[model samples]
Target: MNHFKQTVALKDVKCFALHGYYPEEQLTGNHFIVDLETEFSPIGFDDELGQTVNYEDLNSIILEEMKITQKLLETVLKNIISKVIRLYPFVEKIDVSIKKLNPPMPGQIGHSFVKLTYTPTN
Candidate 1:
């Protein structure tokens, strides 16, 4: 049997966090935007909740990671990817992008982001 993959994109997830390289950044939190895409085998296409990935669970994981982990966006992104792969074993690949709005850059108003892609090993 041949297995097909499905891609799901969760974009523009607004979060408030204090993840940065500078010391003062830790004290001052800023807005963040997260976009995630998870690729997995399609088990079913029914409209029922159980037929597909539970976004509620996914969102919870993302929120929990953002709240507890106060480090670089890269670390946070990697953490999220690890958690997702663990929780959803059927997932084959994933792409995560995290953006910081109103950052403490020299002249830019705000906007620092990172993107990561991962493929789990069998």
Candidate 2:
């Protein structure tokens, strides 16, 4: 069967996070940017919203994942991907990118981030 893929890109989703290895970083939350690309095929594409993924719900899922405290961005990304896949069975693949606006690195304007891709298996 041929599958139809729909790509959704949510860019620069601002949030406050305590995602870092240092104790101070976790104690004091900082700004974060999350980008998501969710790929899924709607069961019935008759221009009906119900037949496809609800973007509002998806945004909530991302926010919920961001609420959970984690040291590594990779872990957070993986968690988001896993939750998204679990919540939406039609989501065959997802790409997540997380960025810290201002990191604690010396002479650097911002911190590092991570990006990960997830694909569900039948």
TM-score of 1: 0.87
Residue 1 of model 2: what lDDT? 86
Task: Write the residue-wise lDDT of candidate 1 on 39-80 in tens digits.
Answer: 888888777766666777778878988896466898999899
Mark the regions of model 2 whose C-alpha exceeds 4 Å error after superposition.
1-3
RMSD (Cα, Å) for all candidates, in order, is 2.0, 2.0
Return the number of clashes found in candidate 1: 0
In model 1, what is the error at residue 105, expressed in angstroms? 1.6
Please report, as a residue range, the 10-residue window in candidate 2 with the lowest summed lDDT: 49-58
lDDT of 2 by residue, 83-107 (tens): 7777777787889898898788778
Question: What would the TM-score be for candidate 2 when compared with the true structure?
Answer: 0.87
Off by over 4 Å in 1: 1-3
